[model samples]
Target: MNKGQISNTLRQYRLLYPLDKLRYLVERNKNKKLNEKFKKDNPEISLPPDYLMYESFQIDYSKYYFGGKTTAEWIFKLLGKHINLSGGKILDWGCGPGRLIRHMPDISNDQSSFYGTDYNKESIQWCKNNIQKVTFNHNNLEAILPYEDNTFDAIYGISIFTHLSKEMHFNWFNELKRVLKTGGVILITTQGENFRPKLTGEERKKFDQGELIVKGNVKEGHRTYSAFHPDPFLKLVFEDVDILDKIVISPKNKGYLPQDRWILKKKALV
Candidate 1:
């Protein structure tokens, strides 16, 4: 690991130590206060689906230590560079509260169109209210996406795959590819080697003690962090595409794992 990676790893460990206790408490109580606040704030809004509600509750606490606009900027930069936005459509897959889209630059000069979707009704409503230029939808993964095949010039899933199971990832991967036009680009980010998983006896003990959090397979809940070797996984999912770039960016401030950005392009017929 480089200096920045090492620093991020150490910072993550320190943040996790205290956060573990907080997470345990939040998990035990399950953010009742937040849920009530959510309901109170949006009186007309129906409660999130059970699974989504649980995931939202868990993330409420986690966001304190690891939420910011840096990741959004990172994604925006990558997408703006590779995606031929001029007269092309783009999908912000799994767009949460329109954060990434909101932070994204006004590429209106590029004449690029923007669309966003999420499983959280509250979030989608908020996006609709806040971002007038971008179209937003409240939809689940199992449902057919509103877009037609070969509709988008590019699509992005920022930190979306990291929280999904392999099956879910495969489903979205295929779906996103189906909607993308030939030569379209897709950018996604996930936890990489800089955020190593615990393995040794000491590491396992540290994990039990809350000094470490291993992100790999998740067995339950609506979402789980699923770590992967970037090359192998991207190769498998994007076999028919070209991996234009694989860049690692260290955490800018602190309290988050280092991330890898995968830039892929759908292959064009010769």
Candidate 2:
């Protein structure tokens, strides 16, 4: 069997978790030299622990640190017009280790409040201790947020939906919709058509036919667990909200495939 087939089979029999562990072990030390180099390179910003950095983002410290600033700029570029000029409330749903949230304060022209929520308590704790000006909260894997309904003027989750289960695609979307103010926007990136080359034969076939291709048996919110959203499938998932725009983001370094960025707006009351 191919690698994808073996992975799917292992997932089917619930034996993929150990493989994920092994993958982590193998990658754990891949970037140690660079990690140390980066610490001396940029001593101004406090960084999370290596494992916490890898847990929330990747093993690369440079990407987790500088890339956050670049991505924060890119997010505002995408949602600049939608940003609240009079100081809006923005949320980073599944914000990992404060990568993107940490840069929002200085990057934006407005005085919007920034809040980050993640299920990883370690990441949240790191943010609470190191990051300033933003609020950090820990949430469970369940589809819920700490804020009340219609609380956020804007929200975004980077690669968050790409790691969830099919059920979560719906459940979390509902919860996000609940907390979003009317006319406010939400930004989420997903593994879209541009990522089809990475899919296995079976997954490619199902994805081409407009199915939600899921690779599970690992922890639901873990990076190893992946889900790919076809355009039609994602359309159905966020049908309750108005899809204002869709941008397919190319890979920064060309190693990974492109991801689709969806700009969704909550509709006004009936």
Candidate 3:
């Protein structure tokens, strides 16, 4: 296995193993206490578990105070420009510990009903217990979700497709389309062309050929496996949906890999 694969495998094992779970539980409680103290001093800040905060946002503890809000604002901007989000049912696909969903109430109209789901049961449970005014659920790795068809007027998955395998990508696209109302909006982010420099030689070649490049082994739909989607491949894969906007969002942040954002609309009934 390549170095990247080795590192990812180790991380996956750490996250999945029982002994590591106990370690994380202890760390989570300690971090929660620190976060609580910080919030108490600040009086206007919201904080969740530090481990979950890192998963959804950044590893830097200081940034957690604003990272979720910044991401939520970006999502709100993208959705707001395309549709009236008020009085609509919106889904935060792959919402991790309510990072973005937690800030929705502050940015969205009161009539809007926000829902969030993630494959991680722990994250979903944490969101359910802590975040108010939103519905949270756990989803399996399969293409099928628990929600009814045509349930959401809009859905957004920040950095979600970036981790899925090729098969899961198409499966999720169909599932997202199935849940969205006709003409409903869907937003997704992927590791785009700008991330090519970080790819291995073989992965870079595949990416240059407009192919989807998946890194390492994929199992149980964990976020350890990474995928890079070329723009053309995304267009072909999402042909059933209308592409409204596509842009690389990392140039502004000099050190980060560029994540391409795509805003799409589910086709109206023929």
The lDDT for every candidate, in the order shown, is 0.62, 0.86, 0.79
For residue 168, model 1's alpha carbon misses the true position, in angstroms, by 1.9
Q: What is the lDDT of residue 45 in candidate 1?
A: 41
Query: In the order shown, what is each candidate's alpha-carbon RMSD?
Result: 8.9, 2.0, 3.9
Candidate 3: how large is its RMSD? 3.9
How many angstroms is residue 128 displaced in model 1 relative to the true structure, after the best TM-score fit? 1.6
The order of the candidates by lDDT, greatest first, is 2, 3, 1
Q: Model 2 scores what on Cα lDDT?
A: 0.86
What ranges in model 2 sit over 4 Å off?
1-3, 10-15, 250-254
Better of 2 and 3 by TM-score: 2
Ranked by TM-score, the better of candidates 1 and 3 is 3
Q: Give one digit per residue, the lDDT tens place, for model 3 in 1-270.
A: 754455455656664344445655665665666665666678755556666765555534445656777878888878989988889999999998777888887788566899999998888998888788999889988877789999999999988888788888989999999999998999998888777766666777888899998764445355556788898889887998899999875575647766888999999878
Which candidate's TM-score is highest? 2
What TM-score would candidate 1 get against the native? 0.65
Clashing pairs in 3: none
Per model, state how many residue pairs clash: 0, 0, 0
